[model samples]
Target: MEADEKIEKISSQTLISNSPSKRIRIRPLTKASLVLRGTLVVLVLLTAYTFYTIDVKDVNFVQGMIGTAKNVKVMFLEPHLSHFSFSHALYQVMITLGLAFLTTVFGAIIAVFLSLFAAQNLSSKRVSVVIKGFAAFIRAVPTVLWVLIFAVAAGLGSVAAVIGMTFHSISYLIKAYSESFEELDKGVIEALQASGASWWQIVFQAVIPSSISYMISWTFMRFEINFAVAVAMGAAAGAGGIGFDMFMASSFYYDIREIGAVTYFILVIAILLEVLATQIKKRLKVNI
Candidate 1:
């Protein structure tokens, strides 16, 4: 009788425990949710105020659109091949390509070293912090300011553009490369270290080979940014490039067709880089 009574008591407790009303209730909105909602409201109001204060109505939107369309049409109708001969447009393209290439290469090389110092796991905390701070400082300054500084220091030319792009490239490359390094499989490094491999050997034999795809992706992305910056720097520094040509064309209100042509060329270059980089990433992914 006592055993039957205990069994009945256990059965009743289980039924009650399994009931829906006995389950713990969770609140819909958390503290984080409320904070995010408040932040979004503030951002929306700020954006509205900013738009209201900016005299966008004073701008000739319709005329500008018509002018741009006409210029684009003229560019397509005109012989870009002929313009390549005397206009130095081709030379400017070459200069921009050369500067971007050199800056990316040199900056990537320097970035590899800097990234080692900046990586928290790879270096002392103080060294990593210092390197990160330096990278941030470099990134904080505008590329245009760097161009002007170098232009005055180097006496106005492609050289200044090259230096400015290189500085900016270092900041980007270091951050990207270090993050890539951090994401690497730590097990491989640990295994290599366990087998009596030196730090340099482990890095070269394991880390770099594994991170090649990410490095390539980042480098190509930086190449696109560097190319755009190089063109802008060329214009600012009065260096010979499409940017300079475009600036001159704009200043004199010359054939808008020429300006359009330069813009088109830049677009083509950017598209090409993006396509090529995509292909590279695919190939790397497949190979891996």
Candidate 2:
């Protein structure tokens, strides 16, 4: 009888404890939620309508690929020394690499200063807002367009490509760096201030030290982007690089093998960069 009573008491207590808390309550949607849903629905409809209007009557999947089978085979099977000499391809690849490196370094140098002022935690709200707004304006324009605009003054070539890529890189880095710096512990900031640390001292000792890893990581990511842009600008802005060779093969003739070789080189370089950045991040143990 004692055992039966104890078991019954435990079961009754469990049931009572769970009764109120275990019930699932549906979230009530407010006007803001309704507006957001309505906006999403409209955007989806617009996207569907746009795709529906495209002309696809001439498209044939098998027929299109069948025509390029030999070229494809040569490209995939024979990646090198098919169309261009090895030395020439190497030169172009080096140019692309150098361009990316230079742009990344230059942009990162400028972005560090800009980010110092852009961060809300470090600067006045008005100044941060203004700086951010300016960066947004610059970023809103496409990379190619920026290059083209600079081309008018700098003339078309590697110079234009470098300037354009750097402009976008700075804007990108500033945003990333500011956000990382902003994430520094507020309590740490308060302690530093209480210890009579000046603004510059706080930033140099606290912010930069804490966020340097993230800064490096963001810069590496931007380098990858700038590299890709350099390739495209080489073709578009007459900036001589591997992209120029690829562009010629694709635009001028049916040089399938050359296209394949250049594409392979680019693919390898991109993969290597990604691997390097990943390794650095892992080694540094970057929190951001």
In model 1, the runs with Cα more than 4 Å from the true position are 1-87
TM-score of candidate 2 relative to the true fold: 0.79
Clashes of each: 0, 0
| Model 1 whole-model lDDT (C-alpha atoms) | 0.82
TM-scores of the models, in the order given: 0.75, 0.79
lDDT of 1 by residue, 1-288 (tens): 999999999999888878966666586778999999999999999999997887866668798899878776786667243334444776788788877899999899999988977877667899988988889998999877887788888978877877887898999899998888888877887888899999888778887788888898999999888888878866788766777777776566566666667777788888888899889999999997
lDDT of 2 at 7: 100
lDDT of 1 at 235: 72
